[model samples]
Target chain A: GDTEPHARLPTCYPYGNLNVDELVQRLAQAGLADARVDDSKEGLVITLANDDVVIQINEFATHIISANSSLREKLRDILLECLGSF
Target chain B: LIMKNNSMKILGVNEAWGELGIVSHQLRFTERIEVEHIGPVQALTSSLHTLLSQKLGTTQVQVVSEYQLSVADSVVINIQDDNDDPGKNILLSWTHQDEALGSKLLEIIKANFKK
Candidate 1:
């Protein structure tokens, strides 16, 4: 019997007033592909989707990341690596 | 697969409004809260002062500044004080993301308004 996979709870981190394009590029550089951006009247919406992780950046300078529960540590490492570039 | 959002808005005694938005994934949480309709400026300030007095352990509520109260473990309530038109002023935000702490802060917010 297959066991249930743990849920990857999303977490949001505010990184000051960060430019959306810069973040997308950073993630893309980190091997996270399929980065998309939407600049609308409301604000900028950016999403970076891959098999291991999915990142959503809202207008409020908050980055919400969702990944597999088991990959949480790896995701953090990647995120910190990307953020450290800033 | 964790994506959920819950929001609430509370109207104060004098038409002041407070809105709370919670985005949860599994045990983690992210929230944004804003308060408008601050009743009277003096009254609201006094209320904030009193509310800020209720502390828990080493985590006492901190008055980060003249108009900001960092309550609970993670919630930060900032009051936008308007002298001439206090009622029109507001509490801009109390936001953070954490496990367990976020829900605890929500309770504190609800309790304050109930007073």
Candidate 2:
């Protein structure tokens, strides 16, 4: 059996007015392969690259968690870029 | 981390809401203080204050805003502030690879305000 590593970077975003559908499309367009969304009690969970990068959107802010630093930075940059379009 | 004016007083401490599996710490201060290299930049603080103060369509909800800064490749600190309440804030710091650095930063922050 193998163990999985985890890391979390909690940050705020304009989530109240976030358009999830558009965000996913923009992420895909940004060359981010395997961006998936799942519903949760708090909000939506956008997982990229087999759970290597996970963005958890709550009512207040978004938490970007990933085991890899580069992956987290790439996803965050794409998300920030996409946020401007929304 | 070094500070010139280290008179900011800590008023209280409480647990804050954090994502699952992530440990968070909260501290209340009498006033906000500027720190060397560790303090948030003016633009970031302004953005956080604006986001915290904005009302969401007439709802008087408790707005929580956070700003993440990567002090190092492995150490990251997420500073959280409350809407309309600057005295009460949270400093949630963690490290991806180096836990010691993250803890040291937190300790430095705590020691500065403590003095």
Candidate 3:
């Protein structure tokens, strides 16, 4: 069995802010034919599988558009920490 | 494969909320949930500081400036001064990926590489 861990990077836009379904569709349209998407209060969870690796993309787009512009640093830190956590 | 995500710390879930400074108390309130919660750049940086200190160990935290950097995985963590709680900052990087393989041999490097 070939079992290897894939690097999963999750980018979130909280507040039900991100259009999870639309993003999924866009990924498929953009040639990401094998992306799987899910949702939670925090945001969306996207999973992509390839021959050698599996990637998890989690994004919670900002609920408040006004706040989104300012939260970039915290968001970046949150993303990296989230990636490292798993 | 590399996966990346961004969001406020998960408020209600215990298992899912770690590394992002979501304490039980902080998680209780909706407003602090700050998922995409923003302010000026300084405010954002402050938020990041709080998150990093809570999730990771606090003493060695570093404060990051100028959000522009090629590599996004690393962060700036702030270390609090014991005297007055005025603090210093350090760059917090989860830079263990390469070091994790340090013990492996050159043959393993050539043979077992998965990427």
Candidate 4:
């Protein structure tokens, strides 16, 4: 438990007034198609192909990713491809 | 002091842990504290500061009082192996008077972080 279970992605660039739902949908479709997007107690939880990777988008619009170092970077790359630079 | 019942509502939990064993958690919440015991706003804020410092094990905590009146208080806590990224370090946020939630959270951390 002392060890962190997930790696976090940096905050995404401001979305301005873009709809979060639509944005997430587009992101999933673009690259995270294999990932499952569900609303958990942790806001939006994205389960990526790598079981270790978990992404959460909170109500405050902050995006956090958790995973091992290698997996985290890989996920970040994929996310950036979908969500753009964060 | 019998007053309105104010409890803390967990809005969200953002966590990021690295292979290096660094951990960071951002907990967002809404607070409705019964101010009867804590007295006025200023005093209540100070009390919250002390409480969080004790539970979180760091006086580095930073508090922002803007949302205290609206119940939209939040706390961003980052327990890391390194604190070089001063920019990302969480000082504090809005305050909550819910001792149970705070204690539970701390307990979870201790249970998990046993080293």
TM-scores of all predicted structures: 0.35, 0.36, 0.23, 0.28
Predicted candidate 4 versus true structure: per-residue lDDT over B1-115, tens digit per residue: 1112464333232221222233333222221111232134444445545555554444334654522211112334332222332211111212122323333444443343322
Sort candidate 1 into its docking category.
incorrect
Cα lDDT tens digits for candidate 2, B1-115 = 1122654433221111221222232111111223333344444444433432241111221223345444334434445433433332434334222333443444444444322
- What is model 3's C-alpha RMSD? 21.0
Q: What is the alpha-carbon lDDT of model 1 when measured against the actual structure?
A: 0.43
Error of 1 at B92 (Å): 7.9
DockQ of candidate 2, scored on C-alphas against the true complex (2 decimals): 0.01
Where's the lowest-lDDT run of ten residues in candidate 3 chain A? A61-70
* lDDT tens digits by residue: candidate 3, B1-115: 2222754443423444444443221100001111232234455456555543443335434554533111223321222222322222222222223212111211222232212
Q: What is the TM-score (0 to 1) of candidate 1?
A: 0.35
Model 4 has an lDDT value of 0.38
lDDT of 1 by residue, B16-35 (tens): 21121322211122232334
- Could you give candidate 2's per-residue lDDT for residues A1-86 as a string of tens digits? 11122223323322234566777887778676588889999888888767456677654445665544455456556555544311
| lDDT score at residue B60, model 1, on the 0-100 scale | 49
Poorest stretch of ten by lDDT in candidate 2 chain A? A1-10
Q: Which runs of model 4 end up more than 4 angstroms from their true locations? A: A1-34, A58-62, A84-86, B1-115
Off by over 4 Å in 3: A1-16, A39-43, A51-86, B1-115
True contacts kept of each: 0.04, 0.00, 0.00, 0.00
TM-scores (chain A) of the candidates: 0.47, 0.64, 0.36, 0.44
Tell me how far candidate 2 lies from the true structure as C-alpha RMSD in angstroms. 21.2
- For residues A1-86, could you state the per-residue lDDT of candidate 3 as single tens digits? 11232233323322222344555565466455676656655544455454111222334222211112123233233333333233
Question: Could you report the DockQ of all the candidates, in the order they appear?
Answer: 0.04, 0.01, 0.02, 0.03
Task: Considering the two chains of model 4, state its CAPRI-style docking category.
Answer: incorrect
